[model samples]
Target: MRKIESSIDRRRITNRPIAIILAAAALGLFASTAVRADDSVGTVTQVNGSAQIERGGATIAAQQGTPLKLHDKVTTTDGSVTMGFGDGSSMALSSSTSVEIEDSTAVNGQNVPSRVTLISGDIHTIVPDKTGQPHSIEVNTENSKATGPSPNQ
Candidate 1:
């Protein structure tokens, strides 16, 4: 009887830790999902005709004023789109173009570390004037990368 009771006690101790670990893992998964649901980075300011936005593992039609999020990919089939950031900077994508919003951060109403990848076609960007802190717009293509005009320009 003494040996049986000791075994039962040990089992209970081990099970309690396992239960706690499972609960913690569940909580972490829930937290990560919630964070991803609220990730908006910019907005589609202009849509000439038809555009599509790939976001959250899905592709959806894009229109003017459509909200954009991190890792979002924008594609213009027969039209064009203009994406505007919070810092007054904008990217104009030509027809048959594809671009991805890789990363962006705003500081004091200015864009910092703003970057985009042009998968195909042409894009024109207008960068806002810089403040004291260094700010730039980076555009990456399959073959090249372009950084914005210097703070002096």
Candidate 2:
């Protein structure tokens, strides 16, 4: 009887820690899913004729769509426009260009976290410095691309 009681006590002690670990893991998964569901919206600060946006392997035309969100992409031809997103981050595009907004976040009424890929032609991005947050802007051409500190940068 003594040996049986000791074994049962040990089992209960081990199970308590395992249960706590499982509860913590469940909470983490829930938090991550909530974050991924967070939507980011973007607008055409400047536009002309017809423009289109791409994302998740799909393309969205300017007129047919309301707006765009994070991980969304944009394309243009024969016109130019500027895009402003949730965190005050903005990008200006020239004619005959295709670009992607890899990430978007907002800060102080501006889209501060931003990333763009210019598939062709030229584009200028004005990146804002948000407090202590990582920020990056990328421009891609057909053969190559560039990134830096300022829009003129």
Candidate 3:
């Protein structure tokens, strides 16, 4: 009976550290997810056909009103999606396109710094008129980079 009790006590001691480690890991994972959820920069205003949003190694269906965060990748298999940013700028992605939201922020209600990489296919953007402070929208492709409000403006 003494030996059996000693063995049981040892098992409890061994299991406690493992349980604590697991609990800590779970809490860390939840904290990171919460941070990502708080950093949304845009929303899927319209989605046609099939689309997905990839973030943090997970791919989720992209539907109208889906929030988009910086570093999020949006892919369209057979249709298109439109994303609208807080600064009133919007992007319309064509079918078979993959784009990553690189950086986006609105500062002082006057400037919106935004960029997207066009992995394939095409994207059309309508940037709202500049409000005094400089606004930039950079579209990058495999072979080219386009900056908007064209030089003619």
Candidate 4:
């Protein structure tokens, strides 16, 4: 009887710590998912003709004010689009153009240097003028890279 009682007491002590650890892990996982689900990097400001956005392997029609997330692929099927990033930088994609939002970090209403990759077609980028403070927009194309505001049309 003494041995049986001691065994039961040890099990109870061990199980309590295991249960606590599992509960804490479950809570941490839930918090991480909540943070990842709300990550929006930019938005589509204008869409003329037809445009689509590919996110997480799913493609959806592009509309004005459509929020853009990191690694999203934008393709214009029959029209053009203008995307305004969180940093106040904009990219105008011509008809039949495909581009990818590479990286963008905003500070005080301006992109420290938001970037995009032009897979095909033309794009016009306009970045905020913070002359002495240093602000820029980066564009990448096949075989080359361009930075700063420029007209690619």
What lDDT does each candidate get? 0.77, 0.65, 0.78, 0.75
For 1-153, candidate 1 gives per-residue lDDT tens digits of 354334356778889999999999999999988866656677889999999999888999998888888789999999989888776667888889998888868666444336777888878776666553433444435444556556565
Mark the regions of model 2 whose C-alpha exceeds 4 Å error after superposition. Answer: 1-38, 56-58, 63-65, 105-113, 130-153
Writing each residue's lDDT as its tens digit, candidate 2 over 1-153 gives 455334457778889999999999999999988765657566777787667877678876765324667666677787876776655566777788877667655655544335555667777765455442324444546443445444332
lDDT of 4: 0.75
Instruction: Please identify which of the two predictions, 1 or 4, would achieve the higher TM-score against the true structure.
Output: 1
Which of the two candidates, 1 or 4, achieves a greater lDDT against the reference? 1
Please give the distance, in angstroms, between residue 17's alpha carbon in candidate 4 and its true position after superposition. 31
Q: Write the per-residue lDDT of candidate 4 for residues 1-153, one digit (tens) a residue.
A: 354334357778989999999999999999988765666777889999999999998999999999888788999988999988665667888888898877867576434335667888777776666552223443435433455544332
Please estimate how well model 1 matches the true structure, expressed as its whole-model Cα lDDT. Answer: 0.77
* Ordering by lDDT: 3, 1, 4, 2
Give the winner by lDDT: 2 or 3: 3
Give all TM-scores, in the order shown: 0.61, 0.51, 0.61, 0.59
The 10-residue segment with the lowest total lDDT in model 1: 132-141
Q: List ranges where model 1 is wrong by over 4 Å.
A: 1-37, 109-113, 131-150
